[model samples]
Target chain A: MGIKINVERTSAPKEKPEISQLGFGKFFTDHMFIMDYDSGEGWHHPRIVPYQQILMDPAAKVFHYGQTVFEGMKAYKTPDGRILMFRPYKNLQRLNRSNTRLSIPSLDEGLVMEALKQLIKVDEDWIPSELGTSLYIRPFVIATQATLGVSPSEKYHFMIILSPVGSYYEEGINPVSIYVESEYVRAVTGGVGNAKTGGNYAAGLKAQQEATEKGYSQVLWLDGVHRKYIEEVGSMNVFFKIGNKVVTPALNGSILEGVTRDSVIRVLRHWNIEVEEKTISIDELVAAYRSGTLEEAFGTGTAAVISPIGELNWQGDKLSLNGGRTGPLASKVYDFLTGVQRGTVEDPFGWIEKV
Target chain B: MGIKINVERTSAPKEKPEISQLGFGKFFTDHMFIMDYDSGEGWHHPRIVPYQQILMDPAAKVFHYGQTVFEGMKAYKTPDGRILMFRPYKNLQRLNRSNTRLSIPSLDEGLVMEALKQLIKVDEDWIPSELGTSLYIRPFVIATQATLGVSPSEKYHFMIILSPVGSYYEEGINPVSIYVESEYVRAVTGGVGNAKTGGNYAAGLKAQQEATEKGYSQVLWLDGVHRKYIEEVGSMNVFFKIGNKVVTPALNGSILEGVTRDSVIRVLRHWNIEVEEKTISIDELVAAYRSGTLEEAFGTGTAAVISPIGELNWQGDKLSLNGGRTGPLASKVYDFLTGVQRGTVEDPFGWIEKV
Candidate 1:
């Protein structure tokens, strides 16, 4: 259940790049952490190897069958220069949940945590100090067995790579316009929707591209059954505010149970706000928006804690909420979440893990 | 658009194995074909390298984004001892169609054919001589750029591998019972439903596993909107015989335009059978089955020429079709397709292409 590390080091970057100029997932650190697992041998050969090419056969299961899963989280740099990683164990648990759905082997959480700590410990300088900027951590597992049959692979590889990233909203936190896709479905029941797997993102890419083409920021995918109920956005869980109640789509096995989403629920509950998890249909939301009762809407994820949604275009009908900007509840939630991450607020839940 | 080959040959197998004992996608030949493409330099450095592991960055885009596509076709040994591939150009066209959906660059069909010819000439001994056995060819393209971003990849790699395969049905073309999955959707309209990409197959694997768990061979997916219209079975196109009409689902974007499906349509039309492509819902199929008008039901694909469906279990109700064996229409269609593929019958449509 534990990892075995074989350590290797690399020279740091010669020129420390500016955090503001950093793009998403382009530049990597000097080293990466890796672990391998087979059916017979559980987990072995954990190492902090130099960031380099990994040799794999063309027929490897990941290439053909897409039996791969990944997690996205960030390590924050506090004002006092102390680095903190937010709830890494939650990410590892979600990774295992994704593994069960894809039929890939799962490694122990302690092993993954140790691997992340080792990598971060070795490459701490890569963490950005900007207000919204931090070191983006990507941990992924892939099926590596060289076979071409349409089944899961017996051998797997898990690796973690770090990249310095700036704020996702470069133009400040303005509410965005999203397209409601009624014709396309991202994930369905009994599918790998709840799992943060590559297929879910892959299925949403075309629709997302369509949204981009149609002059929207992202796509809001509806359920496959009736194309009426709201499921989720492309990579984030959705939350809607109508009057005083905050409602979201229930965890119906087809929508990813985002870590940020769960945290928002806990934080809102702590604040004594009425939070409800139930079936939220598009028709009802449209009616609420038309009646001027839908206070605000936003998306939650690790990349951006809260992205306010000000407009939605569902099948050629346009609707706006809160006058195309952040609403009262959205601002409060964003401030609270970011404040906790940046160590500006009280830490009652101990959500931040100091390294 | 063109490939430049650098041939590096490896020693052949110690001894040629019997073709009858060959399995599917397990054994490979000595040398494999490789090619590379970039936006700045286009395609360059094509090679017949040894079948080996591909060294790639752990954060490669293919692993994270599932931006991958593949084509599956086979090369056959003629009775005259000359090796030929069936519909190679069709595979190339389908590969490009897949590329358009994945936003990857397309390779020239002529270059692909030439490279495949050179590789087949080198590994001619790997082609099985048995009646139902042949050399299975897999050509795949993957995003190889070392980035973790969500946008399209700037660099890609295309490679081809060959494996000797026996019959797809081990029990000698036994009719299989299928489960109609109403809750799960494989592909939807305006999605990558028609592309030969990794995401579609990944989505189907879960349904396939569920069918297997429920004592069925495969799961039949319905239309995403209504969940009542019959779309397809896992990895195959569906066909039904109601009275004198040979009804199949239309070529909707949510359904793959299978090459075998096209051939069957052409053959049925040529034979003057009342073949129609329209939406066939589950309720209509159930009514037909009950009224004794559902003469036969079968699934068509490249793996199994035409597999008969004995029973369909929809929502816990098992509806038996024509007994648990091959029907007259299925046998005729199977014989016609196999004969054309084996070069034993006249190919009036000129669908078969010689390597």
Candidate 2:
């Protein structure tokens, strides 16, 4: 299918924010990509328009039934003045999986890839040149059918917006505290857990808020059934180094397949380190801590890349890892991942897609 | 808090649809209610405006995180031309519950009640006078914060829209078939299943679509963890008559507290019928069916009131209930509920609130 591209540039562009003070998702570029999908017409009318409000009927299914899915990746400005995207095709593949689970129509991968590159090229100046900052790209699809029924929508809108974001942490590569959630669940097997959808994130806000109240930066969710086996963190996939092995919760149908997680595993394997993907229960982690074998724990995602976990509080029992400091393995992984993202390291995995 | 009311009437009134042809949630009334909520400022500027499209930023949290909740109810037109809302306060209370679970600010029940009544009075003519037809009122709240983070939104918009809808079943109250879903799970005990939010419905669309393709009217969801305990029917709560007792799923954390389900339980108790709310697994239901004690099965919700189940297909085995006809108990309950709603029968439960 041929995608006829149309461009309508914005006449009055807004002033850019200070690169030093820019926080995550606080500002957007001048242009965005949008395409519509009718039940019979398929996806059509791909265009780049000014970043502005979207007008939709009040009875759209997204507002009532939450028929939507989304993917998050970033565009990096390398030291050599080149723009790169880490594993762009993986994000699109994950997006298609999400669409299938949410009953949304699939997109043409080739067309979407072309659209992404074009949109980024148009707003290329929006890419941050700072050491730790990048342009966060959010691609989402919403059910736009104007009806008040509990069914799959026949109309949809797929949009891509660009936001110039600063580093996730103000202080680079620092250790943060995480609260082990014993009550609320993020996802369960046989549900939409593996899909990068809005509903799964929406269901986690209350627990996240509670963790924030308790002075924890994030919540480490456990499985919905047993509430003992560890699941991924609400924002990223989790990893723990016990003894000589690194273990992450397996992709048990409920854990999201993070692009960063896959990259980290590949890097570890390339370095001849043992990385196991299996179920790691909270009890086993606590036991490891007791046995003095829990060397390092961290989370992996596109936003922060690698966030070290300094302390874990589970049911009021606090366990400090690496004396509440960043461990050697955690720091090494962080430096290596950021180096690969910024094009300072050799491209062994062919992860970077140049724009 | 003083809620300043404002109203704007539409200059171009829409042509009214034929009452006989009015389907569910297709035609809207002339006006709608809207309010805004910020982090520090509580819900404010409660007003009724002309029904129109809502314009939102592309990066709004609701479009990406599914941060939305909605309530459904109806306004009935009595023979004397008076409008009555059945248990409207219950819906508001339930909406507040959903808000809390979604981390949205709590709504002032008293203020919301006044707003609902005022909006209904303004669009009183939109209420259908035909038998089994009424005006469907939908109240929803959405996170309007323009951010690209997976966190709770600090800004929100609360709105209410009305649609004149005919009876759910055009051919009268007939029994429908249900497919017992064993592969896809809707909600688990530790998740946000109890809240009437959009995510739970979004997660069930795939299963519902598959069931529809298999000649089933709806998918009967099982518990997310066990995948055997009967949970709900996605759009409504399920009930089964075994031997001499009525059994519905208990108020587990994963089951929605439906208003219709509550009213039916109360009415059954008033009639001196044994009503039990507990876990009724599919295996137990199948055993009851084999023993010839399955008697009846039905679903309860605001849309259909009571939808009798004529057959249930679990895996590859199909069991017919009441010989593919509506049962005596189901018919009696439907007539009594409709009669109470239309003001033809004395409402011993004081469920109707006049507008």
Candidate 3:
């Protein structure tokens, strides 16, 4: 169904800085989109209001029960100067999936798409034209009912905010060392692990700090059972390249079904490379490393795009992969994914949505 | 180190209703205790502000990274017209434990105690005098940093909000049916499951819902490693009484060290009841039930001080406990604990703190 759209503008920022110096999630555009849902009156008061702090009761359910869900995508300024979004439909689908898991109400996908387009058009100037830079769009839903009961909230709020961001990695695509936390399980079967909710990231902060203190960049969480099988990192999906065959952990109910992960698999298939999504345990990986068959490892996500995993430290044992740098497969995957996202490569699957 | 607490009071509710009509966390006291902490400033800005909505950034670190901690305790109006808290120091100690685990800064316990005293003195009328009624105090700490990076926040806000809560079991104290979630794990060895953070509750919501959908009141989570050992139920520490011996799951790295759990052990030892805080698996409990040795099963926490477990459904197998209602041991334990909380019993351990 088509969604009714409205726009309310805000006074422009006093000074819009040059796009090169902009940071991630630091600056907001002129407007934000919001809608409310109640048990009696379903989904009322949709508006594009001025960007500002949200006034919330100190006892909001989102703060207590963590009843929240979010989506992250970018509005890229193409060479032709037109604003666009990569796989907007995928983001919409994943947002609904997250809502279902979190017990929050889901909006119509078509309405979300239309509202996103309206918001992007109203704040089109926020889109940066610099290479590898774009306006990040964050659409999140929270339980806004003023009650402290543990069950699901009867009322909710859906809001979208925009921020201009430069490249994630300041350096030119440097490889990262990741810490393997075998004792901590990020997700478990029958848990809300496959959803894009805020709690998943919140649960990973301690491990992330441990990795940072150990001079690693990110954490690699293992399966809840056994704690040996490879699971996705909290922020990104992981992939391993052993010789010519590519393998990733199967979506074992606890791993998120990432949009970029799907795209990567599709691209690999298009290139006629063998892509396997199955359970790959660390023991197998270690044996492969010893035999010199594990050629490369990389992480995939919206923010990081593709991150090369050079070395992994688990239980005081460090294993270096592909000479501690980005390997051939990782480099090619990076260039190809970035090219597709930036509209520099031919769109074979019509994943780009023009705004 | 003394704190100069300046209590600014607000008008109470227009008409104080009877304690029976009170709901869970709906109505609150007039004033709230708040303090701020910063990297350089340390803990400052201690004030009693009118209970109002807080203007928070949409990208606050607590909303994104779950850098939040909370403690749950109650204020009881004794028969002799005294407002008291059941071992407030225990809550302070547990709050510090949770804060340290989540990387959130800790507060001075004495300062926290003084703040509570000032707050209760200002709103003492909110404490209910009826049996099993209480003024639930929720002391929560949240990261107020505006940035979105996945790390500990530099600034924090600590606030205590009070609500009049009626009895948890409106149908009178009775046993509840629980679903044994053998497939899902609440926490891992190195995980933040033991901490009272939003993430652990968020991760447990789906399983709780699943259990509720299957006609159970709560989900009994298992250890992350083997999913065989019992962890906790909903938000309480569990105990199994077999052959006149009280056995609870040991305080493993992943299990929360609950205040009630400690108190129960202390009381049992005082009453000459054998108690052990050792690992108790589901298989052993089921076997005891089969052999007719399991006398009683109960859960203890701030809310629902002692909840009897009537039945257990584990992986399509059902086991019934003694007397589908409150057992003798559970009743005695519940009454004795509430007696100490309400100041009807002598506090040999000096657990009660009068506000």
Candidate 4:
């Protein structure tokens, strides 16, 4: 963990974009963190260099075999110039978990954590100060071995790039219409779905495209083995509030163990709210809706934190929740969570890390 | 379809490796094919240039979202100094099919096929003349857009690289040991399993490594739902010769329709052999083995043509097929298929195309 990191700043620093107009993952900062991994040499040559193009062989394993893993986190800039990251250690741990599943070499979490903090401090000015805006941190690893063989690559690149994102909902908290995807399966029990790899996201793209074309914001995925039990919504963890109890899908092998999902459940339990992780089927949800007890539905992730589900279009039936508006519990969770992330509220659970 | 392809000769040609030492997808040729695709402009700028490293952005969609597809084929140099490729059109078609599933833009198959022929002719000297040896052609498409969004990329690079190879079996086609996996799931019916994409291969690496460590060459995957029906074996279509009936897994949504697989079935039928495509289960296969009617088993793909299965280890039980030797049917299929590819036998089905 005491590895020396070489720092090479860019000679010509480009002007920063208008923070208000910077959408998600569009504008990058001036510098990035780069590290290399060889089979025998292990992960070495950790450095911070100017953000630039990566020269790779056309036959690199990631290009042809999808041997890559990534993690998404956000950094917030408070009014007092404090930089805050939510449960960064958890994200890095998940990165290693993903690496194990994809057969990629693991990175020393402590070393990577130190490098990430240094990179953030180098370009802390790139962090947006808007109410909901933050610096999006994308840490990814790609197989770089240039051989067209179906095996784990012996070489890889671990990189961290930053982008300034605008407020998730600039206007206000809005619940989106979600279509329950019935056709395309994202992941199964014995698949790479739970791992934070590119393949799981690739499997969901077609379904998202179809749902968007049908005037839905995202598609709620059902379990692969049974096309009834709820799995996830879009790329985020989903939760439903039925009657007086709130429930979310259990962390089955095929479901991503989202950090936000865990934080949400913790916060709910801290407030003495019943948050059960259970296998809730679509039929049960529809029945609850018919009985007028389906109160609210929402998705949790780093991007939105809390994306309320206002309308659900499943098969040929349509169900509206909370009269197609943001539910009270969703609004409370959003405000409290964002407030904690941005350092405007108390952090009783030690989820915030200062850089 | 009628696009003009610009050819650029390399100033420095690489020294060709020893034909006998060429193992699989190593030692690429001098020239390679390149093309570009954009959302609005479609596919353009087809050219044949020196085989070199491709410079891509670190944040390219392919690196983060696994938005890529690829195809594999082989070219052989016959004794008459003629170059012949097997079922190229089919590979290109499957490439487009993969692109559609991954939400990438479609490529013009005719244009790609023309460029491929021109490129192969330019590098025809690299083809090896050894028995069972051929030039491995890898055509792949990568998403080049430097955005970290979850959607498909707007820009892409479609390139074809050729690698000189030794025979799949430098010694002889000795049947391999296989482990019938019950833990990992490769693909499901409503997923991208049918597509020739990197994600599918990436999902199989863990199981393959485990099998190899346990003294097995490959692992046989079962259905995601039932986990009993045989789906595929080591990224190839599988067949079982039970009694007088030879059967392969039907082309269900989760199974890839391999070009070699189709060719094998056709040649077997042409010889008046009864080849049935059915949903065969592992239990059924084990039952047949118990009754001593599991005459032969093998896998078909671009690399091996026909890889006989000598032993299958499933759930701590071993089922040795054909007394741990290559069966007559598997040997016959290999002889006829490789013979046709090498132009030593009659091409009655017209599978070969001269370069």
Best candidate (score: lDDT): 4
lDDT-wise, the better of 1 and 4 is 4
The collision pairs in model 3 are: none
lDDT, candidate 1, B147-221, per-residue tens = 776766788999999888886655546688999997667777766778888877777776777788898988899
Report residue A153 deviation for candidate 4 (angstroms). Answer: 0.7
Between candidates 3 and 4, which one is better according to DockQ? 4
- Whose DockQ is greatest here? 2
After superposition on all C-alphas, the RMSD of every candidate to the true structure, in Å, is: 2.9, 1.3, 2.1, 1.2
Measured by TM-score, how close is model 4 to the native structure? 0.99
Q: lDDT values of the candidates?
A: 0.84, 0.91, 0.82, 0.91
User: Model 4: clashing residue pairs?
Assistant: none
> Model 2: C-alpha RMSD to truth?
1.3
Proportion of native contacts kept per candidate: 0.62, 0.81, 0.53, 0.80
Calculate the i-RMS of every candidate, to one decimal place: 2.0, 0.8, 2.0, 0.9
What's the number of clashes in each of the models? 2, 0, 0, 0
Which ranges in model 4 have alpha carbons more than 4 Å from their true place? A168-172, B169-172
TM-score of chain B of 4: 0.98
At residue B208, what lDDT does model 3 achieve? 81
- The chain B TM-scores of all candidates, as shown, are 0.95, 0.98, 0.97, 0.98
DockQ of each: 0.56, 0.85, 0.57, 0.84
Model 4: DockQ against the native?
Answer: 0.84
How much is the lDDT of residue B186 in candidate 1? 79
Residue A175, model 4: Cα distance from true site in angstroms: 1.4
Model 4 lDDT at residue A208: 94
